[model samples]
Target: MEHKIKNKVEEPFSFKKRLESFRYAFKGFVWLFRFEHNSRIHLFSLIAVTIAGFFFQISKEEWALLFIVCGFVFAAEAFNSSIEFLADEVSLEKRDKIGKSKDLAATGVLIAAFTALIIGLIIFVPKIISLLN
Candidate 1:
């Protein structure tokens, strides 16, 4: 005798399920902050920038740009981390395709970081020069 199995479809998320998902996301963020080295670095940089923004009395527009760039870099890094994690989990072995995907994600993060660095230099150089002058 042969047995047939039926496939069950998952229902859409309800409000409670959505809340639980948000809670899980928050927990993931906390876990990342606590354990991820790059996340720690980004957190430190974010704090430093916040302090500098306040201390330097950076203009509103400059502050906006600084925060935007900072957010972009950190978000890209987080995305890179997620991609690498998924790739590693999906393939325990060092597959070339997975490796390339991870590398591309890392490259994206690097590009964002480098762009942020340039923006920081542009924003801060004149302020530093003025201080010296």
Candidate 2:
């Protein structure tokens, strides 16, 4: 006996749906900035780095790397916050497993943040050296 699998047709794109998605995303960003202290810190750092980029006149390649790393850090923070929210809902009482999971999620964001910092230093250090010489 041969089994036939049915593929559901993808829904046609709608302008309303697209707008709704953007609205939801903006809401999420606002929520994170409001509630997540770390996210706010990252936002401040992002602004400072952007201003420095302009002052230094970073090259196209440098700008690309900066933007990519910033995006990764922001994404990492959002994922971490989501996991924390889920964990809090899952259990109010302290449990080792839940604590471990939350710690791991936080560590992921820390790693992304440090990676971005290192990349920023790499890109800008030589420029600093050139200025001092």
Candidate 3:
């Protein structure tokens, strides 16, 4: 026999609900930084880069690029963490496919971080070498 499932009532959109969504997103952001070790490492790198940018007095364009890349790295890290959490929730078994999924998620973070590093070096290296002169 086929079973039918009842759908819950859909609530109407309101300004209050919109604000609550932002609150939930902020909570998740805090939780990610608090609970994830890799997130902390990224946070450290972000801080270091921001200090270097100020010390070097990076151009406005450079500041924009730095902000974009840093945001990308953080977003990638958050996505990877989410995938890991969801995978664990779905199954605790040592499955090959699950392992592969986690690895792929991590690879995304790695690529984002590496790209950010290259951009940072391109922007900062010349400034540093010139200061040495």
Candidate 4:
């Protein structure tokens, strides 16, 4: 017996759909801060970095680099959180494979955070040494 598959029609693009997508993304951004502990940590780091940038009077180019790395870290954290939530939904039981998946996702966030830290030190350490001298 052959099975007939029904083809789904694609919907035409609309401005309304684009607006809805932005709304959904904004909601997810709020949810990340509300439910994700590490996001809050990132927020604190962001604020601190902003303050330091101002105190040091970083050049426009340095500001751009800082913004890029900070954004990268947040993006990594968001991706890691989504993977964790999906893995949990798949199975609440302690499965080895699921645990490994979560670990791998977390490693992305770790790498991003570490890179940001290095950038911060590079930008600030020389200024600090000069200030002390």
Candidate 5:
């Protein structure tokens, strides 16, 4: 006797389905840390700041700034990844305009990352100085 296999297709999602989607979305955060280079860097930076904040007694305002900067940098990196994926999907063959647009998107992320680095340095330098004092 031979057995036959059946293939089933899932239906389109409804509002409840969409809300349920968030469960998987939250899992993306874990996958992001595992797969994304920038996410790993951001996680490392967050851990470092958290340790410093505890040990050096960072002020509330400074912690706020650190959180904001770290969030901005990570968001920019995510945006850059989205742009690259979209651009690649839209133009599988490399066109000059698409290349330029992707480069511009990357530059925006680079600017955000650099700005965050400067902010981090400004916030941490004083803490380090005080520790030495």
Candidate 6:
């Protein structure tokens, strides 16, 4: 069986429409932050990582890499959340396919977070060790 999506907003873009798009995006961001526990956790982690970057006095190259990896993790989280929302909309009832889809989306966020953590540890661990010594 095929599922049908109802709304299609594919109108040609004007400056006003573009501005409205940004407003919609900001709205979504606030909604996500308000409702999603994981988004809040990610935001807190981002704050700590930024502070650590300053304290560690990482090189410019290291700072760039840290920023990139962090961005990737955040983007993955956003995507995962979107997928979860769509999946729930598709089927509110308990279905095996819906459960697996949600799980797979969650796995994307988990993998991205783990990858960022490893990169962060690699960059900071040596700096921390040297400071200890």
lDDT of 1: 0.82
Deviation in angstroms for 95 in model 2? 1.5
RMSD of each: 4.5, 4.6, 3.2, 3.4, 8.0, 3.6
For residues 28-108, write the lDDT of model 1, one tens digit per residue.
Answer: 777677667877887787788788778779999999898898889878877887887789789889799998998899898
Candidate 5's C-alpha runs over 4 A off are 1-18, 27-31
What's the lDDT for candidate 2? 0.90
Residues 1-113, model 6: lDDT tens digits? 12333223444558997898899988888877888888889889889888998998878998898888888887887788888889888989999998998899889989989
Q: lDDT of all the models against the reference?
A: 0.82, 0.90, 0.91, 0.91, 0.79, 0.85
lDDT of 6 at 80: 84
> What TM-score does structure 6 among the candidates reach?
0.86
Better of 3 and 6 by lDDT: 3
lDDT of 2 at 110: 89
Write down the worst ten-residue block by lDDT for model 1. 1-10
Candidate ranking (lDDT, best to worst): 3, 4, 2, 6, 1, 5
Give the top-scoring candidate (TM-score). Answer: 4
Clashes of 6: 0
Model 4, span 65-125: residue lDDT tens: 9999999999998898889889999999999999999999999999999999999999999
Residue-wise C-alpha lDDT for candidate 5, range 1-133, written one tens digit per residue: 1232222133554798777788877666666666678778878978987897888787899889888888887777777777877898998897998899889988987888788789888988987887789
Q: What is residue 36's positional error in candidate 5, in angstroms?
A: 2.3
lDDT of 3: 0.91
Instruction: Report the poorest 10 consecutive residues by lDDT, candidate 4.
Output: 1-10
Instruction: Summarize candidate 3's per-residue lDDT along 1-133 as a digit string, tens digits.
Output: 1232222234566899789999998988997898888899989999999999999999999999999999999999888989999999989999999999999999999999999999999999999999999
